[model samples]
Target: MNQSAAFSPLHRLWHSRRFRGLVPPALLLVLWWLATTHEWVSPLVLVPFGQLYDAALDPQVFHSLAEGIASTFGRLLQGYGIGIGIGLALGVGMGLSKAFDRIMGPSFHAVRQVAILAWIPLLTAWFGTGDLCKIVFVAIAAAKPVVMGAFEGVRSTPAQLLEVGRVLGFSRLKMLRWVILPSSAPAIVTALQLSLIYSWFAAIGAEYVIGVMSGGIGSVVMGAQEHFRTDVVLLGVTLIAATGVAMNKGLRGLPDYLFRWRTRA
Candidate 1:
């Protein structure tokens, strides 16, 4: 039960994929530092690694980044939560009832075909360039994948198992809770992950296009682009990529724990 024994080198190595993945980037960083040291690449375009790191540490930039990230993450989570909740509810409803599916499936598919970006103008008009607009974008992006995944998951629930559940006096709600939900959990997890990624992308696009005026990673990139500061842009891109990876890992943990029953199933 020793903590050190529990967290061995293998565990450390496994959990350190981010650090390991940084090797190549680290090498590239070294190369860039060397190039800048030697004045090989123009200092104006390719800022030195040290300077980039320094810029990131700058109080103004750091404060801006913190504010931007907090704002964007808040919006993203709000939209994603709404999307997941609604999609899951309706998906279960449609999957459980053939009449419901038949009634709404076509319209759902048709609307889902429309890109999230396509709704930007209307969303802006309705909600303005505020938190609500960003939420709308994130929700639209998150909803479709979740709905699709839920539809497939529910539709593919084993017919024989469902019949058995009905024969056992399982009510519809009981059946969904005990049978369908367990079976479709993996798909649901995948859908959630996809929804998160979609939300992330949608938020970025909305911020970029509408210019939220508030701080966000997208705002940082926009500012950098406006100032012709490619280095800052590169830094923003790197931060975004890093943050996405972290978020993906956080999401993977949820399914691993929630669907642990699958290991036996």
Candidate 2:
């Protein structure tokens, strides 16, 4: 057999979709190394890659990182779950009934216009800068995207499909179960992904605000900044970005698996 005819497993692996996605990050890492090595920016402003890696791996720092991640993840789940539930309920109701849409649409849009951060002060006052306030802030951040996604999904469901359901004499429940829900699955999935991302960001932001008393990755980063531990701050940022990417990939897998047919078509 010709040498070229024999496929190289390593070559194939390198060109694989997952591996290809790492190219940009790898390039960025190289750029970061260059910038730091040449003193494009002072070490104080941008810690060298070596120091950042060392700080990230340090046992003491690792312990704090682990604790902060665990706390933040727990709060993310709590807030995200609550927000998703409420968004789904409202979206479904508004989508299904014209009267409901008319009654709630204006108020919903109006409220959504308010910035997520704006609610933080009121929430802090109401909940007293504890886990509850942070959770509520995260929930608010997650809910807006979810509700919008759900609403758009439901509204965009084809009228022909509904007509088909009607022609088949399907009851409202049956129509919703078989027709509406399936049609809206994609939108809901997208919304879920958005909500998850928003929740993570909100959780971090809330932690940064309340984390001095409470504790999370945000708090760790803030404390590091106060103490002039730039390496630790960079480590926290890296962790947050990596976690966000991991979460998006994980959540995306579900929809991709469930909706494989859409891609096949």
Best by TM-score: 2
| Candidate 1, residue 66: how far the Cα is off, in Å | 1.1
The reply for model 2, stretches above 4 Å from the true place, is 1-43, 262-265
lDDT tens digits, residue span 130-239, model 2: 89988888888888888888888888999999999999999999998999999999999899898999899999989887656688998888989999999999888889
If scored against the real structure, what TM-score would every candidate get? 0.83, 0.84
lDDT string for model 1 (81-112, tens) is: 99998888778778778899999888998998
The model with the greatest lDDT is: 2
- The clash count of every prediction, one per candidate, is 2, 0
Candidate 1, clashing residue pairs? 68-215, 68-216
TM-score of 1: 0.83
Q: In model 1, which regions exceed 4 Å deviation?
A: 1-27, 228-231
lDDT score, candidate 2, position 68: 93
